[model samples]
Every structure is written in structure tokens, then in C-alpha cells.
Target: MNKLAYALLTCIVILSLSTSCEKDSIRVPVQTIELSASSFTLATDSVRIVVAQLSPNNTTDTNITWTSSNQQVAIVDQSGNVKGISPGTTLISATSPDGKISASCEVDVIKWTLHKGGLGFVEEGINAMALDKEGNIWICGQNVIKLGSQGAWLMNNSNLNPSAITFDNQGFAWIGSGSGLYRYDGSKWEVFTTENSGLKDNSIITLATDNTGRVIASHFNRESLLGTGASEFDGNSWKYYSSANGLVYDNVISMAIDKSGVRWFVTTNGISSFDGEKWKSYGASNVGVAHIGLVHSVAVDSNNNKWFGTNSGLIKFDGTKWESFTNQNSGMIGGSVTAIAFDNNKNLWVATGAGLAHFDGVKWKVFDRYNHPVQDIRTILTTPDGKIYIGTGLGLLIASLRD
Candidate 1:
């Protein structure tokens, strides 16, 4: 009787131990892994957090490792966070600890910063933009906006509507308004008009700073029958020029100083060049163009080639020859070119009535509402830090370029 009881107890204990060992050895392996996003775009220095999901809720080995296909364009941390390094495309992946189950996302790293109408800007359009000595950007439309590291702030300049703005080498900002010309030295502001200065008229339409630190302002009165030419301020004295003097036209629209220190004044129907002592003129009949009055902006490239932005198209005068680029002849998206600027890579960026075009001297890329949120580009400017600022009717578009 004792032997039978002992044998039964031993069998019961052995069965219990076998059942417990079998239950503890059972496990559920990961079958599938998926990411939240399939693809997305990010700007340089920007970050995006991604999420990974596993097929089984009670996965035994849920550990994952995040990695980037191209670390130069983007990087991924162990927490599934991706940061853009430059402009390119990279694949971000989340893999299981055993490298069997994985999921991925295509990340397009672009150097683009878009500021919509009411986000950072007070208005919809930016008529002019200038960069100060401290690398701050100043824009004028309905109000004067200064954008820096601290963000954007409005400047109270007597509630004047600025038409043009320029910053001198001495860090002073000169703004031209319809009523008068104003100057600000970071802390103080001074205005000059027909009643106080040697300006021929009270309305100033354009402003530019020469290499010698002289501020040049052009007056274009909409109420008057004709324009009042331009004025030059050499920090202490003022000099006036008009049709009665040596200027080719009294209605100056824009001015540009070439690399050789020659000042070029562009009017509605003519182009004037002054080399400090002599003045030369080029009109529609002389330049072989149909209508020179369509010219709206002028830019000088690194090679000293003069490029003109006109309503009809873009014109280039390379000293001895002239060339034209229009929608019918080139890949330009629009026929009316509003603004033109050259970047550090010598890429010509043109803002037109329809879209924004970029010319890398070999190819052309046009961006519009289909690919971007830009429309009605009014002005464009490039900074030394490889940033391109575009003022449009929608808002301000800032693009950063790497190589």
C-alpha cells in the first residue's frame, strides 16, 4: 500500500513540472511591421518623428533599430526620429532586433521654408526686401517687417507706404516712400522731402546704394505729368540729376551698379549708363527691341552681363550681343518676368507672373502651385548663406540650398 501511494505522488509531481516547463517555453514571434508614413518631405535642420507598428500585440521581441540609408541627407535615431541634413532623398528604416521584420519610409530632404500669409507676415505681398549688416531681413509691403533669429516684428515708420528699401555699408537703412525718403540708423529715423532736402520731388520710387556708400533715390510721381529723375546722398551732401542735367530720362524705374562701378539707370523706355563723367542712352529703336517700356527690373550677373526683366520676356545684353528668352523660345514658365536674381551657385532665379523658374545655365526647373504653394511672385533675393527669399502674393518662400 505505501509503494503504490508513493509512485502515484511521484507521477503527479513529474506531470505538473512538465506542464509548467511547456507553458514557459511558448513564444509569439513578430510576423509583420509597418510604418506610419510611406513618404514625406522635410526641410534642412528639421526633424520628424515616425512610428512603427507590429503585427502581433504581444510580441515577445519588440525591440527595433532605426537607420538611415543615406546619413549625409538624413539621420535616424534609435527612437525613430529623423533629421534632415541636406537636400536629397533618403530611406528611413525600422528593423527588428533580429533583422528579419522591418518597415521603411521614403524621406525627401529639401531646403524649403514656407511662411504663409498670416503666419509671419502681416500682408499678402512684399514689394521690397533688404538685408542688413547683421543678416536680418527687412521687407516692406503694407508694413515694414524685420525678420531675424528672434522672429518677425513690424517697424513703425510714421505709417508710410514704402516703395523701395536699401541698406548701406554703414548699417543704415534707407527707405523710399511715396511722400518722402527716410533714413534709419538702427535707433533714430530722419526723413527728407522737397521742403527740407535738395530732392527735386517728394515722391521716391527706387533706392540703391553705390560702392562708395552713396544712397541713390529715384522719384516717380504718379500725379505729376513726368518724373523728377534721381537724387544722390553722400552721407553729408545731396546731388540731384534730371532730364535737364545729364540723365537720359526723368522717369527712372530701377538702378544697378556693375562690377566696374558703372551706374545703370533704367527708365520706362530707355536704359542710361553713367561712368561718373559721361552718360549714354539705349532706347527701343537703338537696342533693336520692340518696346523697352515693358522693362520692370534689371540685374547684373557675375560676368557683368546685364539682364533685364520685361513684361514680354527676359533680355540679356552681353556687351556686343543681345539675347531674348520668352515662353515661346525657352523653358520659361511665363512671359512676364517680374524679378531676377543670381544665387551663389550662379543659378538664375526668375519670378514671373505665372510661376518661379530656376536656370542652372544648363537646365530649367519651374515651380508653381502644382508642386509648391507659390503664386504671383513679385520679388526675389539671394543671401550669402545660400538662402533664397521669394516674395509672392500668397506669402514669403524661403529656400535653402546645399551645393
Candidate 2:
């Protein structure tokens, strides 16, 4: 490039032609057409990238031509803006009006078609999502991932089968996997298992962080057939609870913390509420739990009302009465509810076996795979940045909760 610049300068000096035949007339050197980059590799999300940078700091010619060898692969405008059209390679050439001193850039476009993005992170079997202290999103699949604005990195916990994820009040992240409960304090990870911590069992299926920063986890205990209850950590010690300690069932799938600081656990038998001192059990007769065999998830709204997802339908209890919303009365396309989450706008996002349902307190909107990318959404979460993260059976997804 330097040699080319010197040659252009020599040509400019050897030329005796001037713009105007007048005394003390200034001469403009030949615009040395040089490109900043010789090649580029971009994604569908990065179509609006600069293809090349022209040299000759002072070139008043607005007629520089930018052309692509294959417009189907990529297209370049006169301003040197390159837009990737497909998953292929193309050569973008820039030429002067006189057809001299030309340069070219090879562009390769890649497509990253995931849930709701063009490219960034791609994974399968995503189930849970949580936010870190820096606002980065952590998604759970076969392992855990810390997804940020820059990109995504997996926090491999020895390939632990992560089932749930949550963030504590102190900005620490807790992951519940089949192996154990792991906590990440940004720098290091602390593992809690039956052999290490106060965990009654090693198969962690669900995790919940209370207002007091208590990390509560549910044990799956499916293989061993010995998981008797759930475990709780007060940032110092571990506590276990089961039928012997007031739970009606030992197979707990999900948990939630209400406004009154009560921890609710969704079990196969019923719902268990713990106030750090006492434990209360509610069944289908009192809490309006239907004949659903399995309770999938649990959540609490801003008003402290408890929400439960079951195979039959969605149940909501505002501390007094339990209301059951199914296909008969609500817009739930599928009767089996898998997960539920509340947005900043007080809207309830529900994931069922058939589609995704949104309730803004007045109406219901359903999004299925036929129209949207939603399919078998397993879990849902809304962050303060107004981004709704949904994990389907396929992979992780991001959607807008905007009306």
C-alpha cells in the first residue's frame, strides 16, 4: 500500500495538467484509491457493516463506484456500506470514474438463525434463564451460559444437567442441576452437594431466591428414589424440609417467594408454604388445585398473589380464592402449563404445552409456532431491561413483552 501511494504521488507530480490555466494554480493529486480492509466476514445480524474504507483523505469525487461481484451474496452501496444478502461469498470492488486505481474486498456472510436473533449464541434444550449483576443473561441447557452484549460463554459445571437458575439479592447466581446446586459469585463457583453441604440430596431440580437472600432448592430424587425433601441456604448454613418437616410431598418441581416473605413450593401432592418458622400445606380442595397430577412451576405476582402451572391448566390464588383458567374460560391453547412469569407491565406470560400465552389482565394473546418462533416453551423470565427470555425445548429465545 505504501508503494502504491508513492507511485500515485509520482504520477501526480509528472502530470503537467492543471484544473485551470492560471498563475499560482493549485494541483490536486490523484485520489489514491486504497481500502482499509481486504476482506470481511459478517453475519445476517451484521449486514450493515462497512465494506471498505477509501484513502486519499481529501477526495471531493462523489462518483466513486462500489459494486459487488454477486449481488445475491452481498450488495455494496456508493457509500461503501455492505449488506449481506445470503450465506455466500462475494467480492466488493471500488473503482474511480476513470476506471483506474481500483480495490476489492472479499465478504463472507454467515447466518445465525436462532430463537429471536440473527446471531450470537446457539444452544439446544434450553430450560431456564437468570440475570447477573452486570445485567448479562445466564441461560441453562445441558450446562449454564453467561450471555452478554459482547457474546456468550458457557460456564461448564463439569457438564452438569442444569434444571433451574436464579439470582440472589446480592447479585450471585445459583444453578440447580442434576448433580448439585452451584452458586456463582461472579468470580468463583461454590458447589453444594450431599457430600459437601447440607443438601439432603444431590439431584437439584429447582431453585429460588427469597427476599432475604435465601437459596432454596428442590431435589428431584428420581433415580435414587430416596429424595425426601428440599434444601435451603441462608448464605451460611443449610436446612432441609420434607414430609417429616411439613411438606406434603417430596417431589418438588418449582418454588416461589411471595411478598410476605413466604416461600411456596410446588409439589406433586400439593403446594407447601413456609414462613421460615412454620409450614402450611394446601391441596386441591382448599387452594383450588385441580386434579392435575404434576405441578410444573410456581410464581408470584407483584400483588403477592401465587400462580401455579399444572398439567390441567393455570391456577392463581390472590390469598383468598383460587381461580382456574383453562381452554374453556381463557385463551390457553394448551391445557398443560409449563411455566409462568410476570413482566414489568404487570402482564403474565404463560408457557403451555401448545403455545405461549400473554395476559394483560384484560385480554389474552397466544403465539404458537405457526406464526411466531414459540414452540414448546418450557420456561419464561423478564429482566429489568424489558427483555423477555423464553427457553423452549429447542433452545433459548429473546422476545419483547411490548404491547
Candidate 3:
């Protein structure tokens, strides 16, 4: 009885222990999968794309499938290649069949283009511009132009031969051409030439009006005709002045009236100022103005400081001293400054033959066609809203200072 009982008991215990061990060994493998790039941005032409895959402990799992929720936007292949169809957002997902693990990434497709209201207009060019006291912009450049809150052409004469233009306090626009001066009182164009009105010369090169409603113009002399230094329109009659009347140069290119109602005439040789009483001259000999000595434009800042744009560089007269800035010294990109204007913020905007440059008392910002090239920025004006309008040989460009 003892031998048979002992053998049976030992067999039963061994069998029970073996069954428990077998049950515990039957376990399922855990699956883990992860994506490499959280987000993917691609152009609209990308075809073959590779996304990394991460597994906990299994590397031999080659059975991976990729899919996109929106096939119209993006499509994914079995080899993890993603193709972009259009500009939109789509979710790309990858799954490992063997491990039963899945991962997903967002695909974003975007397109880029040049903004017209920004610095991109530099590729074009500008010609001329005028700013009213309210900071409204009126420009005449390449194509049809306007400015500020109200985009008015300011010159709808349909005649594109205007040489120079000036605006008075009453918002009247005076345009100078080969014929004479044309006045625009926001409605129609009135022609004032040597044949009809009191214009000193028919070939008017520049125009300027004083506070006393006196219109001043400069004329260029050709062979058959005599060039007048300056002319005055006192509402009733026309008065012409030349070298015999103590004028510096007969060939006038530009003109500007200072805060004191004094007329400043710019010529190919030098600069001349005329007060109500006498005429004064300043040029190469007295004022150290260098380079070609040809004054192209002149402007008066808010502080009553006179600024001159010459073929060489820029000069500032503070009544007592003279400060000069050229391409070599200041950040002016070019020496040929064609136009100059002061904004409401007292920032000086200079239009050069090359591009546009701005000076805010301390720093200088130059905008060229390379970075944001504006071709031949003939005129620069700032609106009251701090937006800068550039008149280029191509068309009109508007830039936001807040940017």
C-alpha cells in the first residue's frame, strides 16, 4: 500500500506543476510604433517622401502601409512616399500590420507669391508723386496712379508730357510741361502758356507757388528762344527774370519756396534764392556743394531745414551750418537723388535714380530691386496713416511702415 500511494502522489504533483508553467508561458507580444516628423510641409510637386518609423523592439516589421484622409490634397504610398496634389491640409497615417501599431502626421501645402501692397513693387519703377497737407497721395508715374484714402488721379488731362508738378495749400495742382503751366482745381485742367497767359516762357521746367498765391516757374532756353531764369504769376500778369535781373543761372531745373516765402531756384550750374527785396546765390565757390553741381530737387523739412538733392548727393542747410550726405558717407545707395520729401513724422524720403532710401534722423533704410527693388523711384510720398507711396517708372507702389 505504501509504494503504490507514493508513486501516484509524486506523478500528480509533477503533472500539476508542468500545467501551471505552460499556462504562464502563453503571453502576447506588445506592439509600439511612432512617427519621426510631427509635421511636414512640402511644395505642390513633391512625389516620393520618406517618413521615419520607430518600434519598441521589433525591427523586422516591413509590412507597413501609408494612407491619407484626403486623397485630393495628398496621397501616400505603401513605401511611405507622399505626393502633394493641391494646396490644403491632410492627415497622413502609417500602420504596421505585423505589430498592429499605427502613427500619423499632418501634411501642409502652401504657395508663395509677391504681394502688390508690399515691398514687391520694387521690381517695377516709379516716376512722380505729390502729397497734400492732409497726407493724401497723388502720383503720376508709369500707369494710372492715385493715393491715400481717396485714390484720385490728380491729373486726368490724358496728356503724359508733364515735366514737373506742384500742389498748393488749397489742393490745387500745377503741372509744368514744354508748353506752359496747367492748373487743376480738382475738377478740370486750365492751360496757362506763353501764348495765352502771363507765363514768362513756354518751356516751363519747374513750378512753385508761394503763400501769397504767387505762382513761380523756371524755363529752359533752346536755340531759337531766350531762356528765362524765373517767372512770377501774381494772379493778374506774368513777370519774367533773366541774367540781367541779378538771377544766378538762366537754365532753371527745379524750384522750392521756403517757410519765409523765399524762392529757391535750382539750375545746372548752382542754386539761387530770391527774397522779396534781394537775390542771393550759393554754389560751388561759397557752399561746399560737390559733384556734378546740378540740383535736381529741393525740399523743406518741418524744422524749416532746407534739403537739396543734386546729381552728386544730398545737402542739408540748417540756416547756420551745412551737412552733406553722399553714397560713400551716408547709407544713400546712389549719388543721383532725383526727389526728396518729408513725411508727417519728419522722416526724410529720398527717391534716387537707383531705388528708394529713407532717413529717420538716426538710421537709414535703403530699398532696392535686389532685396525689394523699386526701379527709378522718381517720387516718394507718405500718407497720414504712415503708409509710404512710391512713384516708379513702372507704376505706383504702396508700403506699410508697420511692417
lDDT of 2 at 152: 77
Q: Write the per-residue lDDT of candidate 3 for residues 174-195, one digit (tens) a residue.
A: 7776766878787777888778
TM accuracy, model 3: 0.64
Q: For candidate 2, what is the TM-score?
A: 0.68
Each prediction's TM-score versus the true structure: 0.70, 0.68, 0.64
What's the C-alpha lDDT at position 89 in model 1? 75
Q: Pick the candidate with the highest TM-score.
A: 1
Better of 1 and 3 by lDDT: 1
RMSD of each: 11.8, 18.0, 14.3
Q: Show where candidate 3 strays beyond 4 Å.
A: 1-127, 132-136, 141-160, 221-227
Clashes of 3: 12
The runs of at least 3 residues in candidate 1 whose Cα sits more than 4 Å from the true structure, single-residue gaps closed, are: 1-120, 400-403
Local accuracy of candidate 2 as per-residue lDDT tens digits, 213-311: 988888876677655578989988988888888987888888988889888988887788988899888887766456445788889988888988888
Span of ten consecutive residues with least summed lDDT in model 1: 364-373
